[model samples]
Target: MVSTQLDAHEGSGQNSESEKPTHVETEHAAVTYQEKNAFQAHADESGEGQNTKMTKRRFMALVSQAFLWTGSQIPVYLFGGVPPYIYADIGGHDRWTWFVLANLLSLAAVCPFVGSLSDMFGRRYVALSGASFIVLGMIVCSTAHTMNVFIGGMVLAGVGAGINELTALAATSEMAPTAQRGKYVSILIFTIVPFCPSVLWAQLIAAHSTWRYIGLFCALWAFVGLVLTALFYFPPPRVNSEGLTRGEILKRIDFVGGFLSISGMILFMAGLQWGGYMYSWKSAHVLVPLILGAALVVLFVIWEGFFAPYPMFPRRINQAPRILTLTLIITFISGANFFSILMFWPTQAFNVYGHDPVQVGIRGIPVGFSIMAGACIVLWLLSVFRGANRSLMVISSILMTAGCGAMSVARPDNMSTLWGILVLAGLGIGGIVVPASIITTIICPDDLIATIAALTLSIRVIGGSIGYTIYYNVLVAKFTSAAIHYIGGAMVKYGNITSTEVIGEVIGLTSISLLDEIAEVPGIAGNEALYKIVIQAGQIAYAEAYKWVYYVSIAFGAVSVLASLFLGDIASYITFPKYQHDSQEFERWRGVRMSCEHSLAEIITENN
Candidate 1:
């Protein structure tokens, strides 16, 4: 019979093979055994488990979770492409950054807490609550009349998104065997295939109907998810919370840690978002929050590491500290790289490539397809190579780095090559994201999967926030200087308009939102030749600015590559013991199984 014990390193951080347990007695393992016996008894009574097919109820549960996952992703994919229309309708040209920042900050802030709550309370209600929040937030967003009100709605939706995202990942991961966890997660992600064109959908909707309808549609989708979750998606009770009373459970929650983590993330990201955009980096408005938030975050880490009884990041993760730490680092850099593309690709398409909304959306389709394809490729590679995670990650990071570096060559003349470049980058993103997450679950104890997953996601978002700020500042600074030089010089040479004040006014109106208004400028009006020259100069200036962004991005990609190189081996963790039971017992146990073809107990069963 195959060994039923996990590696000693996974259990007690021991290097001695003799120290490993004969039948791992971890809480999660115990729970799996109990679940196995229960499933077996049920299957015996029903004469089921005759084949290796998933049950209808379990399939529906997976489908329901998929819907929730798609709903959560809508805001992420939609907002990036539709923000221009949102700003136009809501009149928040000056405060537009807040629209994106609000959602991101809230989503990042609540993730750790959501993981804790899901682990402590159970998955069903927490997930349902998230769907409900999405519904309410979308309704508010759809009906909002002002930017502030809309931002408020986004804050609500962001919280729900965080909760739902973590819950779905944890729920789905638990249902699959360790050996095939990555594959199952990839399948879950496949549910978003319909929304791959979400960027285009947002643009098309704005052109045909109202931007508010986007909110209405999201709300409707979330409502369906909420109903499905309410009807299905039930899993077994959490072992951690089985015997705890209501009051006891409340006492067990680390409210102090939650407060510190949430507030620290919000303030830190808020400060970053505002710095150099709304306020100077040195201003007290930015420094105060940045300093205070950093201190609080440090304190929260200390609390979780030393004081909290039920820490969000459990100590078990320390067993494979090197792998865990490296995985998170890779995850962080990947987020930075991914968001850089998501936020700026459209800008490049509009200003440099000179595409209309529809065309821009169509161009973005390659990115979505490439990301999904990359993820699928990684899953297949993992299975074929039996989880050569470190090698795969290094390769993916290299692909991403090459793709990002290649983007420096993007120009209006070579628009054809941009599609292939984007596909390469998208594939890297898909490869890195799913595997980094799966690795986290592999190294840690099964019970802490939700917490670890949440922490990984939170880190990624934080990295993205910082990356976005850096790229934005770089683009603005470079673009402003380049635009003045190119557009101003062209106006003087071509248009023979040399008045500095008039030049300044014309250039100021050259922003993407106000680009058309440049034709209406006092000196430039009725001067078609001058207008064409200025437009060309502006496009060249945008290309220059975007090139600098991609160049800086290469440095980040290099960091990801270095981090991936140091990731410790996770091969042993991915292997599972074969089921040693007779065919009759296996048939009886299979009927009630919900997760996948094999239950955790069956995967690790030892012959008596």
Candidate 2:
């Protein structure tokens, strides 16, 4: 392996043979600069090439984009940590489902359209608009006096997040050199690095100050993002080949399809969330929306396939059957496992262990850091190998499977063991995102980068919403039945002076804080042994219920591993079109020697 560089004199067609690009002879192949056109050669000379250092101008542009990136992602993980305050200040637990669903539904609805619009118009304006929406939403949330207003604010915020998130990723991919794209995108993972800290921060602020101040801080953060985007961020210019006008662009909006998809997703998710908690599966409250949502999904597919002038998701990319299939599969499974763990593990810490918000947040630091570390690991691997990411995917899924399986057996006595399991699961979850993003970037045409990125992200969000709903239901059912069984059995066997109704009432409430309060009631307060029995029963119930959800996650992880095997090798697909380099053919020939049956070390040795 050798480092190679090309100057304008080498390939701009302005010099004689002596000025041609140099090549380095290697054991397998000669490494050389590849120029697709004279225009690119000139562009490379202007310091835009992979080997050239980025200009100060371009570095500042990335910094500006990073501000927007942070503001957009703050709303995502912040809510996961501070839901208690949200429910208390805005709505009760009964309305908690709406708060979560509002942003997700709006995000799912808007992402495809936002990506398409950015491609149609420009990234800078779209990003500015996204930042503006976030600011407005945060303000509304901060000032809201009613649950309805708060939900509305969340929906707006979700729309902004949807636009900014995908646009930032696309811009990063387009700006960075092919070899360094993974490195740059890995930086985006920092947006969620506050997952644990945000919980602690929000709790600290809420405890000493007001929860509303947190919203104000985010609003101001987005305001700064808005200013930075306006002053600095600008993407390369593009125009439609057909010379489409404003009206023409509007005609290609695919409003009907977007509406159907968004509405369908919201309805289905709402149904799932309400079914076991607020309403029974047989109730019309759940069934009506679910059936309607399913119908709309069918309509969405039909419209995209046959009716839309320009589909939200391009059909051409779907032609790459294996890559498309694997991308969705891995993203979907990982999304489910990722969300279930993030949303539930904290609940376990609070409920079974009687930890406060700060303690719960502290307990989550291992998982949060592990996620960032996992993403960094993949970036390093991609940089070193230049592209064989299939192994990383397989390894990540295996770890996730093992981690979740381990979690299913966690007992209250050994709850500390969750740290190890969470680390493995977080690593697996974070590792999975990179290969899928890289594969999508490599397989699709340069023009469709944003559109494809948005499509893939939307799929992950939808998968997460589905996962959250499923796990919420699973948690409720398991906790309710288990709690009833343990408490009722204890009451019957040791029919003491304590009221069974009081125990049942306490079990009905889901908040962890209530469990602590229940132990100090007048009747049980004087009886140390009875209080111990009650607390022990509550811990066992919550922990056992949590284990069931973990088991389900294990199943998702196992399926992800099997799906990853069919992802093909990433090395074969990676190509730097801007540099006119393609390794597809060479990778094919090389595959014959690096067979799957051999040890990984043997394969690496043979490749070297």
Candidate 3:
């Protein structure tokens, strides 16, 4: 690998949706004095002809993108199984609220700023800076003094995460051959596979040490990313075809859409996650924020669609595939279907499976492994059958819907059913990601790819965060209400029925873990005086909660099915938005790589 100083040259590169004008591009026709070097000079491997490949830069670039990719969604995904696994000591309900609130706040605040800064300066600088933020955030979180500080740390992590998250998608989409988009993104999608390691890390901390170890362990990953990026020399993909410069990107920036989107997502998550703990879902405190949040989202959509120039999601992209948007939404919603199960499954398994906390977590290993395996298989199949993207999406949705559907119908006694449904869910997730990537790749143009990728992730994170909060709130409420009803007020007045312990005894059992279990128990006093409310109330409440998880899945599944039907297939990308660089620079860069894959391909196939 070799580094080069700015040779004071010009060339063509692709333009992105975010670019404005550039200082150099503006003065191209006019003569120049000294060249302004906004970019730090770095070495790139040179090749004999057109076969140039920057091995060191590519390695570091992949390392950075892959590392950040691993951290993105898996942390939250593990929370599904983990929240239940840790909710007892850490205060499960409160944990969700703060986690979502903190992280969303970070994402909402950071993504646009990172995008804008990267838009103005460059992706490399933004990514490295973000990497530093992640490292700092991890240390802060590892040493968090209280819940608030933890939230603050997560906010910092989110900022770093936002930067890291966008790099691979944006970079890969721009660099990969058009025909290879699905496979390329799928390969990157495998980064989530590393997330399973986090589960082990989290479990180790939860069981052997403090949860702080989880955050502390993340510091290592972030540090590795930092080192890789700081040393890397990946050539920037052409994103400023129109010669957009730092000054212009800042000037035309739309701060409002970013603000409203972030604030709305944060408030909504906080309120929903707080339900039952901070305030009942129906109570004024929770209800007010939830309403306010919805209103803000509405305002954000209007503001972005009508007011903001270069909106995060421009209207043209929206116009292309309505169903694709729906698919993204449903994938997130159904992907999150296990929240209620995660909340209560361990408790249900306690007496039923006779497993302790550690054993229960071990039991969840299958579910975790299952999700990873499913995704790999889907990625493989899609790679083999490139045309199956749409079909694959439908299949993914169906799998998810079925899996969650089965879970919603499970009873405390039905351990087999519970495990089976979760496994199905794992398989469904495999199919979801590949198809979803294909959808995004096909529908959106290259210029908007980076912004859209960032937007998609944010939306999915918000959906998963809120979905769990809402699901858990309803499940917990119903179970609590049923427990109370089954205890019988008259018996309670007589000092007979007291806590869940007494309620458990009334049901001819030692414990009750789910709302539905209360219905199986015999009515108090054998239907004696004032017994009407207790017997039926338990049944009704349990039934209500049981309906939600399944019903929501079916609804989302139907929507996704429609979304799959509405997608449009776009063609290949070869000559990208020509960055303002002239033929000389293009030839120069190509000359550097002429000995790499490009030259090798031409030479090997020149006969054809």
Clashes per candidate (backbone, < 3 Å): 0, 0, 30
RMSD to native for every prediction? 6.7, 8.5, 10.1
Off by over 4 Å in 1: 1-62, 115-122, 169-186, 232-242, 499-502, 575-608
Residue lDDT tens for model 1, 1-608: 01213222234432222331111112221223222331222222122432324677666777777878888878757767776677767767666666666787788777766633655666788899898888898888888888888888888998898888766765665554443444556677667888887778887887688888888889988888888877877777654444455566567667888899878877877777678777898999999999999999999999988998876666766668889899889988888887778777876777887647798788788887887777668756765685599999999999988898789898878889988999999999878876786677666665454456567777777787778877887887788789889999999998888898888887666654466778888778999988888988888888888899889989999999999998888766654423325565444223322222122212110000
- Among these predictions, the greatest TM-score belongs to 1
lDDT of 2 by residue, 1-608 (tens): 00011223334433322332101000010011221121123222222444436766566666666767777767655665666666666566666656666886687677767644654666678888888998999899889877788888888998888777666655554555443444555565454555446666666666677778877988998888788767766655433324455566677677888788988887888788889888999999999999999999999999988887677776765646786788788888877777677667766776677656677677767776776677668646754675566777889889878887788876778767778878988888877765565566456543344455566677777887898888888888898889887765554445464566766665654443354455555556666776667666777888888888888887788788988887766554443233434365344323311211111111110000
Q: For candidate 3, write residues 523-597 as lDDT tens digits.
A: 344435434344444444454456565566577666766666554432221122242277765665554332221
Go through the candidates in order and give each one's C-alpha lDDT: 0.71, 0.64, 0.52
Q: TM-score for each prediction?
A: 0.84, 0.81, 0.70
Choose the strongest candidate by lDDT.
1
> What is candidate 1's TM-score against the reference?
0.84
Alpha-carbon error at 522 in model 1, in Å?
A: 1.8
Model 3 weakest lDDT span, ten residues long: 599-608
How much is 156 displaced in model 1, in angstroms? Answer: 1.2
Error of 2 at 503 (Å): 2.4
The C-alpha stretches of model 2 lying farther than 4 A from their native spots are 1-42, 45-60, 119-121, 170-196, 234-241, 382-389, 487-500, 510-536, 575-608
